[model samples]
Target: MTRGLVEDEKKEEETEKKAKKAAPAKPRKKATKKPAPKKRPDLEAHPTPEKEEKAPPKTEKSAETPPKIEKKPEEKPLEYKNDIVEVSVYHKPGCRIEMQIKASQDMVKEAHKKAIRTVSKQVNFPGFRKGKAPPEMILKNHPRDVDKSWQQVIADVAFKEAQSLAKVSLLD
Candidate 1:
C-alpha cells in the first residue's frame, strides 16, 4: 500500500511540470512614440496682402467733411524766434563769462507751446489721439512738467547762441 501511494505522488508531480512547460508565453507591449510639436507660421515666406496691411482710417476726418481753413504757417504759436531772447554777458577770468538770459512773454509762450507739442507726441490723453492733445488741457493737467520742458528749451537755445557768439567750443 505504501509503494502504491508513493508511485501516485510521483505521477502527479510529473503532470504539473509538463502542464507549465506546454502553456504559451504572454506577448510584450511595444513602446509608443510621442507626436511631434507643430511648427510656427512663417510670416516672411508668406507676407500679408497689401489691403490687409493698411491701417484703420482715422475717425476725426472723413472724405465727405468740409475742407478745413488753411492758416498762415507763421501764425502757429510754435514758431521759434531767435531774436526775442535777450542775453547779457559779464566778462570773467579763465574764459568763463557770467551770462544773464531773459526771454519775452511771447518767446516764453512759444517755448511753452513747443514743449506741449513735444510732450503731447509722447503721451496719450483720454478722447484725444497721439500728438493731438489741446494745449490748454496739457497745461492744466501737467503744468510743472510743461514748465520744466519749456525751461529746458530756453536753456538749449541760450547755450547754442552763447557758444556761437563766444567763438569757443562749449563742450569740454
Candidate 2:
C-alpha cells in the first residue's frame, strides 16, 4: 500500500509540471516618458516701434457737450411703531441687527393672566376638576410654574412684535 501511495503522489507532481509548461506566458508592457516643452523667446528683448496716427478733428457739437450727471432717489428712514411694545434697533457689522424691546405694563398683565390659565391646566386642586381650577387658586398654589409661563408668553409676544416692526423673518 505504501509503494502505491508514493507512486500516486509522484504522478500528481509530474501532471502539475506538465500543465504549467503548456500554459502561455503573458507579455509585459514597457514604461514610456513624456518629452520636455520648448522654451519661448522673451517679448521685452525685441520691442516693436508703435505707428503715430493723426487725431480726428472735434466738431462744435462734440466740443460744447457737457458730461451727464445722474441723480439717485433718496431713501426714507424706517419707523417702527407698536402700542404694546417699543423696539429700538441698532445696526451692527456684517449685516447684523440688534433689537431692544420694552413691553408695556398692559401687555405684561395680559401675559400674566394667560400664564395663570396655562399653569392651571397642568395642576389639580381639591373641590375642582383637573384643568378647571380658578386662576387665583392656580397662581396661589403654583407660583413658580405661573411665573415661568408668564416669562415664556412675554418673550413670545415681544419677539413677534419686533419681527413685525422690523419687517424681517425670524427663526424660532
Specify the highest-lDDT model's number: 2
Summing lDDT over every window of 10 consecutive residues in candidate 1, give the lowest-scoring window.
72-81
Q: What is the C-alpha lDDT of each candidate?
A: 0.73, 0.84
Clashing pairs in 2: none
lDDT of 2 by residue, 1-172 (tens): 9999999999999999999999897777878777886656763477779899988898898789976789665344345768888887766658777777889999999999999888888888889988899887887789999999999999999889888878876556
- The runs of at least 3 residues in candidate 1 whose Cα sits more than 4 Å from the true structure, single-residue gaps closed, are 1-82, 166-168
What TM-score, over all chains together, does every model reach? 0.46, 0.51
- What lDDT tens digits, residue by residue, belong to model 1 across residues 1-172? 9999999999999999998888887878889898896776863477656664677786666656977999645321122234665556655559766666667677677777789988888778989999898988888888888888988987786667655654436645
Native RMSD of candidate 2 (Å): 14.7
Per-residue lDDT value at 70 in model 2: 92
lDDT of 2: 0.84
Specify the poorest-scoring 10-residue window by lDDT in model 2. 72-81
